[model samples]
Structure formats: C-alpha cells, structure tokens
Target: MNHKYIAFETIVIKEIRRFARIWLQTLVPPAMMIGLYFVIFGNLVGRRIGEMGGYQYMEFIVPGLIMMSVIQNSYSNVVSSFFSHKFQHSIEELLVSPVPNYVILCGFVAGGMARGLGVGIIVTLMSLFFVDLAIQNLAITIAVVLLTSIVFSLAGFINALFANSFDDISIVPTFVLTPLIYLGGVFYSVELLPPFWKFVSGLNPIFYMVNTFRYGILGTSDVDIVWAFLILLLFITLLYICCIVLLRRGTGLRS
Candidate 1:
C-alpha cells in the first residue's frame, strides 16, 4: 500500500516538475493568450456590445474564459505529457513496474489538474483587472471547475493511450475541442440562439460545463445546475473507466 502511494506521489511530482521546468512554454503562453482575449474581446468589443444576460458583456464572459483556460490546459497537459512518455518508451518501464494502472492514471490526471487549476487561478486573477468577480456560490464554483478539469485530464489520458504520433494528439484539440468550446456558450448565451441552434447547443457537453461555472459565478444559468453536474460526473466516470481499460490492454504502450 505504501509502495503504491509512493509510486503515485513520484509520478505526480514528475509530471508537475516536467511542466514547471518549462514554465515559459507551458504556463506563460496560456496566460498571455488569455490576457489578449480579455483585451480584445472583453475590453474593446465588449464596450460596443454592452450587456449580455443582464450583466455587462465583460462580466458575463469572464467565467467562460476562465473555464476555457482550465479546459485547454488540463487536456493539453495530460495528452502531451503522456504521449511524450509513449514516444520515448519510458511508459513501458512504468507499466512493467509494480505500480497499479489506476495509480498511474490518477497521478497523471492530478498533475494535469494542477496545471489546469494553476492557470485557472492565474486567469481568474487576471480577470479581476477586467471586471469585478464575486463568488455567488463558492461551493458550486469550486466544484464545477475541479470536476471540469478532471474530465479533461482523463480525456487527455485516453487521447494519449490511442495517439500514434504527435500529430494525432493535436488533432482532437484542434478539430474537436476548440469547436465545442466556441459553440459552448462562452461568448454568448444560449438564450440568444434561435430555437434549433439552442437545441443543438444543449447536446454539447461543454455547454453544460460553461453554464454551470457561469451559474456559480453569476448565480444564473441557462441550464439546470443539477443536470449539468450529472453530465460532468457521467463524463468523468466513463473516461476514467476507459483509461483503466486501455492501460491494462497496453493499447498504445505496446509496440
């Protein structure tokens, strides 16, 4: 038991250090890019647009943007880190060791969560410069962000398990994740969407995440909070199970 805990701790620390060592590449860039979004979208265009969802446009978008940072960083950190291990064949050593698959998975996910939540805190602080934020529901706010990060972190692990090359890792983020985020009610409310598009947005998993986070901040949401949480939990369960199964099967680890 102690050995498994030690292994888990070691892997988590290694993953954290790997990104911390490259702070310029991993951390600085996301903060800078999100800062740019605040400047362009929140400050400049937001003035002309005025209010959205009964709040100032800048305020309305802040939660979504923060959630966005968390999602992207969490997903990218795990996918890239795990894939690198696979690429260098170090993952095989870990797999062959006495470490349990669940420990390995949890370690990587925790590291990803660290990066994701770290960037989230940075971005939240940055958002303070653009608009005032008061937590409407502290528990809900924290819960959604944590769960959302875990979901993406697990997702990134799964992506890495199946990834054949560097190119394969980027494919899901570019073509799939980004599109979902934009359409997920980040910049605008689903209420503004026409009937058909509103129904379509309901199908997007990210839609629930963004809205739930928004609700946490603003005390308002387009979707029911209970249902949104259920969806997030569902994703986490499915992804975690999938990752464990893949690890046992040595999906991409076996050459």
Candidate 2:
C-alpha cells in the first residue's frame, strides 16, 4: 500500500511539474483570452444585453465564463498530455512498470485539475477587475467546480484512449463541447428559448454544470442545483470506475 501511494505520488508530481513548467502556454493564454471576453462581452456587449436573472449581465456571465474555462482546459489538458505520452511511447514505459492503472488515471486527472483550477482562479481574479464578484455559497461552488473538472478530466482521458488519430481527439471538443457550451445557459435563460428548444437544450450535460455553478455563486439557476450536482457526481463516479477498469484491461494502451 505504501508502495502504491509512493508510485501514485511520483506520477502526479511529474505531471504537475510538467504543466507548471509550461505555465506560459497552458495557463496564461486562457487567462488572457478570457480577460478579453470579459472586456468585450461583459463590459461592452453585456451593457446592451442588460441585466440577466436580476444580476448585471457582466456579473451573471462571470460564473458561466469561469465554468467554460474549467471545462475546456480540464478536458484539453488530459487529452493532450496523455496522448503525447502515448505518441512518444513513454506511456509504454509506465505500462511496463508495476504502477497500478487507477494511479495513472489519478495522476493524469490531477494534472488536468491543477491546470483547470489554476486557470479558474486567474479568471476569477480577472473578473474582479470587471465587476464586484461575490460568492453566494462557498461550499457548493467549490464542490461543483471540482466535480465538473474531474468529470471532464475523465472524459478527456477516455477520449485520449480511444483516439485513433489526433483528429479524433479534437472532434468531441469541436462538435460536442462547443455547441453544448454555447447553449449552456451562458448568454440567456432557458425560459427564453422556445418550448421544444428548451427541452432539447436540457439534454446537454454542460447545462446542468453551468447552471449549478451559477446557482452557487449568483443564487439563481435554470435547473435544480441539487439535481445538477447529483448528475455530475453520478457521471464522475461512473467515469472514474470505467476508466480504471479500461486502463487495467489495457483497452488502448497495448496498441
């Protein structure tokens, strides 16, 4: 058990250092882009859009923008990092070693979480420059953010394992992530959508996550926040178990 923990710690440390070493690329650029969005969308455009859900448009969008950053960075970090290891054949070394598969999953997922949370913090501070940001509930907010990061990290790892080519990895973000995020109650309330479209949008998991986080911070949400957290927790648990099982079986690692 000691040996297992040591191995897990070593892999996690290596990944954290790898991402920290590339802070300029992985962390800073997202902060900059998000800052620009805050300037344009929240400052300039939001004024025209006016208040949303009894909050200033700028304030209302902050949580969604943060969640958006969390989701994208978390997913991209694991997919790119793990896929690089496999492409370079370094992952073969880890597989050949005695380290357990769950630890490997945790190590990679931790790296993604670190990078995602890092970017989220920076974006949160960046929001302070735009509006008087406030936390309506600290516990629920942090839990949702952490759970959302874990879910996406697991999803990214799955995507990496199944990626036959680099293009396959990008397809989900492009086709799935992008559309779902744009419609994830970021810019407008679901009530504003037509009845059929509202139901269609509800099917997007990102909606639950974004709304839940929004509820935590702004005290408003389109969906029940409890249901949102439960759905996210269910996905995280299922994804974690499935990922461990798949890795232990060398689903794509052997190839």
Candidate 3:
C-alpha cells in the first residue's frame, strides 16, 4: 500500500477507535435521547396531533429524527475529535507528516461519516419500535443519508478549523444546529404552516434534508425531492471547497 493510504487508514482507525472506546458518550446517548423523542414526541404528543401528511405523527417524524441524529453525530464527531487534537497540540504531528491535506481531511470526514451512519442505523432500529418504516426508494434514502453526512462532516471540519477553544466547537450545534432541526419541519410539516411561515421555513437547508429523507421513507413530501437533492449536493460542494481552502491555508492548524 502507498504511504498516503497508510496515513489515511491510520487516522481513520484512530478516530474510530477513539469514539468506539467511549461508546457511552459517542453512541449510547443518541440512542437513548432519540428513544425519548419517539416516546414523548411520537407516542405522547404525536397521539394528540393525529396524522401528518397522511401518516401517523410518530411515523412522520421518524425520518426527520433519523436525519437529526445523523447531522448531529457527524458534525460532533469531527469537531470534537479534531479540536481535541488541537487542544493537545498533537495535530502538529500530522501537519509535519508527508500526508497530503486532502488525505487528512478525508480521514477525518470518513470518521465522521462512520459515526453518523452508525447513529443513524441505531436510531432507525429504535424507531421501528414506535412505527413501521417503509422505504419508498431505497436508493434515495441511502443517497440522501450519505450526502447529508458528507455535508455536515465537512461543515464540522470547517468549524473545527476555525475553533480556538472547546466552547467554539459547541456554539454552532447548540445555537444553530438545534434550532435548524427543530424548525426544519421535524415535528410538523411545512404544508401546515401559513403562507408566510412556509416561505420562511423554506430558507432553512435542513428543511430540504428532512423532507428529502421523509420522502424516501414515507413516500410523502412537501418539497420537490429533486430540488431537495440538488440543494443538498450544492451545499456539499460549497462546504467541501471551503474545507479544502481552509486546510490549504493551514488556517487554525499552524497556530
């Protein structure tokens, strides 16, 4: 194997092991937290709301919740892992190595993807306990999930690149990500929103992601699935370019 492949694989393995060794923090909480969303939001509150988009409210939220889990986990894994290395001053070790910048970026992004997909799978399995999920299009479902993971993973890397402290890594998720997910039609549909609010919700990119995944799972959607996908790809390209630029500049790593 080439040295670049070796370096990439090593970083990937290291990141995977780092999170796997702390399963309680990395994996278990998402499962339990999403379980509560199902029990409280899906079973308890959803019962009062009846059908959303012609399906049980619980059923309607499943795809969104799964997407939520994926977005959070993928972003968190890269941000925290990379920031931790920065904090420890160990990132310089990689910087001094012969590994290319894209290789380094890919390794971290792949690690993020692994954890994101892992949590998504776990949440999907747990969701089955609440409602039966039927995939309207398996290809779209997989493609959206994969693309969403890559987008957030790249975003997380950018966040990490500019992060100067541990708190910086967290600010985006708490203030930005959480709000986007909640207002992204996770618990309700945009069609139910009034005209003005519906237009407003359309501005949130997460809205597209949740609706696309929902269409894949339930065969129902308020947004055009093709447009949702195109928007997703567009964001992925933008974020990837931003990450590459930051990496090449050695923005946060050199300091």
Candidate 4:
C-alpha cells in the first residue's frame, strides 16, 4: 500500500475511534435533542401550523431537522476534535511528519462526515416515528446531505485552526451557526416571508442547504436547486484551499 494512503487511513481511523470511544458524548446528545424538536415542534406546534410548503408541518420540517442535525454534528466533530489535537499539542507531530496537508485535512473532514451521516441516519429513523418519509429525489437527497456535510466540516476545520481556546471553538456554532440554522427555512418557507426577509434569507447559505435537502425529500424548495449546488461546491472548494494554505503556513499549528 502507498505510504500516503496509510497516513490518510491512520488519521481517519484515529478520528473515528476518538468519537466512537465517546459515543454518548458525540452521538447520543444530538439524537436526543432532535427528538425533543420532533416532540415539541413537530407534534405540539405542528398541530396548529397545519401545513408548510404544501406538506404537513411535521413532514415538511423533518428534512430540515435531519439536515440541521447533520450540519451541527459535522461542524462540531471537526472543530472540537481538531482543536483538541491542537490543545494537546499532538498536531505538531503530524505537521512535522511527511503526511500531506490535504491528507490530514481530508482525514479529519471524512471523520466528521462519518459522524454527521451517522447522526443523520439516526435522526431519519427517529423522524420516521412521527412522519412517513418518501424521498422525492433520491439522488438529490444523498448529494445535498453529503455536500452539506463537507462544507460544514471544512468550515469547522477552519474554525479549529484559528481557535485560541476551547471557548473559541464554540463561538461560531453558538453565535453564527445556530442563528443561521433557525433562519434557514428549517421551520418555514422563505416564500411565506415578506420580500425583504425573503431576500435576506436568500443570502444565508444554510437556507439554500436546508431548502435543497427539503427539495430532495419533498420535491419543494424556496431556492433554486442549481444555485444551491453551486453554493455548496463553491464553499467546499474555497474552504479546502483555505485549510491547505493554513496547514502549509503553519497557522495555529506553529504557535
């Protein structure tokens, strides 16, 4: 086997083991929180909302909730794990080693994707208990979820690189990611918003992701599918380049 492949595999396996060893901390909390969303928002509040985007309130929100779980898990996994490596000073060893920067980056991102998709599957199963799910476009559903995970994973890696402390790892998710997820049409359609708010929502990348995933499952979205794909791809490219550049420059790693 190639040495590069070995290095990549080692990093990925280490990351997977790190989370798997703490399944309760890494996995269970998200499932439980999403379950609360279903019970409170989907059952209690949905009864009154009637319908959204021409689907039952519960059904309409299921995809968004699942996507939300995926996004949160993916972003959190990388940011926390990579930052922990930095905090422990283990990352310095990898930086000085022959393992390619992109390999290290992909390994962390792939691990994050695994956890994100794993939680996504668990959330989807949980959602089935409340509402029947029928994939409107299987291809689109898979593509959107995978792409969204990659985008957030890369974003998390960037956050990890720049993170000065544990608190720094959290600021993005608390202040930035949470607000975006809520306003990202996870619960309501952008069409229902006034023209001004609708335009504002359009500027939110999460809006496009949530709607695109919703479209994959429900065949409806407030944003164009083409534009959403473009955004996901664009973010992945830019963020990946940024991660590599940071690695090569020894940002956060050297200091």
User: Per-prediction count of colliding residue pairs?
Assistant: 0, 0, 0, 0
Give the alpha carbon lDDT tens digit for every residue of 9-74 in model 2.
887788788888988988889899899989999999999999888889999989999999999999
Candidate 2 Cα lDDT to native: 0.90
lDDT tens per residue, model 4, 1-255: 999999989998999999999999999999999999999999999999998889999998999999999999999999999999999988877988899889999999999999999999999999999999999999999999999999999999999999999999999999999999999999998889999999999899999999999999999888899999999999999999999999889898885
Go through the candidates in order and give each one's C-alpha lDDT: 0.95, 0.90, 0.94, 0.95
Tens-place lDDT digits, model 1, residues 139-168: 999999999999999999999989989999
Better of 2 and 4 by lDDT: 4
lDDT tens string, model 3, 116-170? 9999999999998889888999999999999999999999999999999989999
In model 3, which regions exceed 4 Å deviation? Answer: none
CA shift of 75, model 3, Å:
0.3
State the TM-score for model 1: 0.98
TM-score of each: 0.98, 0.96, 0.98, 0.98
Off by over 4 Å in 2: none
> Model 2, poorest ten-residue lDDT window?
246-255
